[model samples]
Target: METSSGKKGVWAKIISFDLGATGSKKVKFYRQLFGFHSTRRRGTQTRRVFTPGILSKIPHLVLGKSVVAVPPEACSQLLDFLSNPQWKPIQVHVVDGLLSAEQVRRAVEEFFSRPVRLTGGEVPLSQAVRAVSRRDAGDPDRRFVERLLDQLGRFEWLKEAVRRAKEELSR
Candidate 1:
């Protein structure tokens, strides 16, 4: 966990490291609802290969030896990990610091904890709603789906979860 110990009292935190397409976001989400902290983001220069072994190399973000990973891969990989080996017993919540990218390279460039907005600045709920509606129908291409989700701002529920996960990340 990266910390600023030079000043102030010791603040124990759970720092979650999210490496996505756009950038690497390291945030410490306090258990108290709405409390959050972020790390200086590292932007991605290239898209990474999504091989399982390769994907495991991200430095283990362990809380006393417990490790968790929300990999930088396709949604299918997330599905496979969940179904095949039952990777994550439960879904982990995040503040969505990194806005999902349309292209893998773009995802690599995003910063962790930097939420993506649908239009100008704010995240849209419409985009999220549209994405779910389209994806549920098995639409082949959902390019516009993501746009709609951002417009919908459907991720409002994730705020507290992200905060809790942040504590887990930092530990």
Candidate 2:
């Protein structure tokens, strides 16, 4: 991962590389990792101490083989940066909570010209990339469609998109 100064350092590698949100919530994980804190008064409030500078300081995040789990707000900027020709080959795994499945799919497809699949659970980066690449191989099998539906059904936010995908498949 390259910092804003165009230099690779220990902080960049440690945070953007190995520190991935696998089983935990992405927002919470990022906050804790970046030293930001949240509190509840009458309503929930988050301390904006370290977040603004942290993200700005890191322009391009290179996860190598690891999956990149970023906050929803940063998704657009990350996608834009990674859409460059040099970064095209990298496989990205956008954390799927706040953003709808369709939104993520559209963003990725628009940027990378590849379809997105919701694994419904944590999956190896290689496996997820292979699944998407297979879907792009022209004809999709019924079994693949069925499995995709099953995975999409796991997330409530993806229910509408799943229905749309089923309809498209039926056609």
Candidate 3:
């Protein structure tokens, strides 16, 4: 896994290639060859693909969405891979590193100007709540919220969010 320059986020692959050269020239050569951009932030250098433009060059067979139910910022690190275009033969996987199925589908569809299907299952309610709330609330707390929401007739908030997401994706 690769962490983006103390950004405290992890990516699937972090590669280091030695061209036998040092300094900024090496960074330039690497960027020219592989299209990975390097940035020096707070005295540390980090390599990343900041924009979707570089995705035009990659041949992605499949795009995968995660079922972790994390917020957008938590999974923003995966944009480099997710924004790539895919072909018919490619198969998509619902793995870790996405905000939500409908959101990603909408993004991919909008960027490629094509209808796309995102496959994923509902995250476990407990897991979903924790990830959504960004906290490690215990069972009693979760149960309390569930019961309170049910009593208040707002228990369907998650489902409603998903439905709204689908509606957004359709546009």
Candidate 4:
């Protein structure tokens, strides 16, 4: 059945890539609130890339009736993208690294003007990894490896690695 907005399902489009502190919260928000469980299919990664190369794709994929929860780091870039005259109008909300249920509900309501009930709970790191991994078979070890690869490619990790490498070389 379609919602009054003509959109099907309750899942929100979240553009979070990492499973770290902030990323974890966004993933949990998508899962618990929107029931957006990542399918166990290869190449089902979230279209969260914010580069100019994929900007058009991201807007096409997510700019619709579903509420989009953007990570704080992507907020500025996403805002800039939305500001482009060529881009269509879209609703967005930037979530902090952590939040309470009340905060989440308020943010959603403010962005979409619809009341939403959010459950508050912690998803274990291992389980979150398994949930977000693209492996067809549910293997804990493989999920962990996939999660590590995902984390390592994040901007924050790259920045830290470069910083540490520079320090070690200087010393």
TM-score leader: 2
Candidate 3: clashing pairs of residues? none
**What is candidate 1's lDDT per residue for 1-171, written digit by digit as tens?**
123543322111222322221212112111111223233434844322221231221211223222232333222343343343223233433322222222222222222223333233323232333333434344432334333323323223232333433333234
What tens digits encode model 4's per-residue C-alpha lDDT throughout 11-114?
A: 22354332223456544433432333222434765432111232221211232334344434445665564444433233445433333334444443232221
Give the Cα error of residue 168 in candidate 1, in Å: 42
Q: What TM-score would candidate 3 get against the native?
A: 0.17
Q: Rate the local accuracy (lDDT) of all candidates.
A: 0.29, 0.40, 0.33, 0.36
**Rank by lDDT (best first):** 2, 4, 3, 1
**lDDT per residue, candidate 3, 28-103, as tens digits?**
5435433443344655655332222222222121332211222233233334334334211223233334233454
Choose the strongest candidate by lDDT. Answer: 2
- Candidate number that wins on TM-score, 1 or 4: 4
TM-score of the candidate numbered 1?
Answer: 0.17
Show the colliding residue pairs in model 4: none
Error of 1 at 9 (Å): 31
Q: Note the residue pairs that clash in candidate 2.
A: none
How much does each candidate deviate from the true structure in C-alpha RMSD?
Answer: 17.2, 17.7, 19.1, 17.9
